[model samples]
Target: MLRWFLAVIGYLFFRFPGAIAGFVLGSLLDNMMGGKTRTFKTSFGPSPTVSPADFELHLLSLASLVIKADGSVSQSELDYVRQYFVQAYGKDRANETFRVFNEVIKKREISAQNICNLLRQRTRYESRLQILHFLFSIASADGRVSEPEVNEIRRMAGYLGVYSQDFESIKAMFFKNPDSAYQILEIDRNATDAQVKDAYRTMAKKYHPDKLQHLDEAHRKGGEEKFKKVQEAYDQIKKERGI
Candidate 1:
């Protein structure tokens, strides 16, 4: 569909004033639909691609991955995400991102593979990673780790062609112990027993698996694993800290 539209636009551009009329119409449509036109160099023919709505869906899914990583989404986390949009694409683009995000949140089902194809076509690795990191940062925006958000990150990661080991390494950069704790939990090494207990109580309530069991089975499975890991991490911290 994308190729067809581009071919029609190109032919019209070279063929007649009628093409100019198409350009005006297309521009208006593009503005209304959230699309940007760009020239591509292809040996065989036009690139196989879908519409900008598809791209918006893809990016919005990635954003949700961040918000849902631990188990629950918070207002602070959402604010961080909006700030990310402002930093990366400005307020206008951010508003479009939020619209797409709202649509995804209401979706019945979504696939990361679909997102992968869109990202492969529309973005380079650095760009995609930046988006992913932005999502990660948002998950921890409230200065704590939520289990659901982490699980979402793991499930959606495969579609990005990121190896699990490599992804863990990147994850380590954000979360303190990719194995035991979330990076945002940020419990100090020398904290008092009371502080450790307080931290554990906060995290325990945050990652309760039951809260997210209603998600799709696959999603629930991932959530369970992350919740277990969170529990394990918190326990280890307690044992060491004698809290």
Candidate 2:
């Protein structure tokens, strides 16, 4: 399905060469997915089995893509990725992964669309949201999220099938515009107090840490932080509305 879809899209855009490229990417996806019957059990539920090594490599590729999106790579951003892996996977494993990432993954030309497509197929929606949040955190490691980085992440959100509202909500967390609280709650500023409360409840459920039990410890920590952000957004809304 992915191959055919990409092939048609490639044909439409770049004709023969585009079609060939799309087909090649499609084949890569096929190999990554392997057998359809494969499954892995997790706390949240069962998901398609994507080997941990492969998943890590693709994830690192995505990280590298984001780090380089704004023309210059920030040491802070690179350090953030390293520290995150160290915290999540422990020192030895993090170092090993970083070795491969630096020597192999970071040097490659990655297709963000291809990586996102694989993740969209293999991972849950909530997991993808966490991934986006992590990417934003990386982008903001140097204390500012550049426009180019935001744009790249937004394109990733589209490929990952994350809703626009959800994307904006995550973006708001890192950007802090006037309507940020409302954006985090996924409601409009004009929403009534009751509507705001309802949105909070919905977002709370969406970002609840329990939903990410299937993920690794690092991601679970991320989910908990996201849940806290939702609560904080709600609190801010309530204070403004005197609710």
Per residue, candidate 1 scores C-alpha lDDT tens digits across 1-243 of 333464478666676555556666676666765544432222234554445445555666776666655556678877775665566456886688778667766776666667765565554343344344445666667886566766677666666655565355335545654343533234655666777677666645544456444232433443454455556666776666565
Segments in model 1 whose C-alpha atoms lie over 4 Å from true places: 1-35, 38-57, 100-108, 177-243
Sliding window of 10 residues with minimal summed lDDT for model 1: 36-45
Best by TM-score: 2
Residue 104's lDDT within candidate 1 is: 62
Candidate number achieving the greatest lDDT relative to the actual structure: 2
lDDT of 2 by residue, 1-243 (tens): 788888889999999999999998998897767763334343356656777766777777888888998999999999999888888878998888878877875466679999998888888888899999999999999999999999999999999899999999999999777799999999999999889988999999999999888777998998998999999899988888889
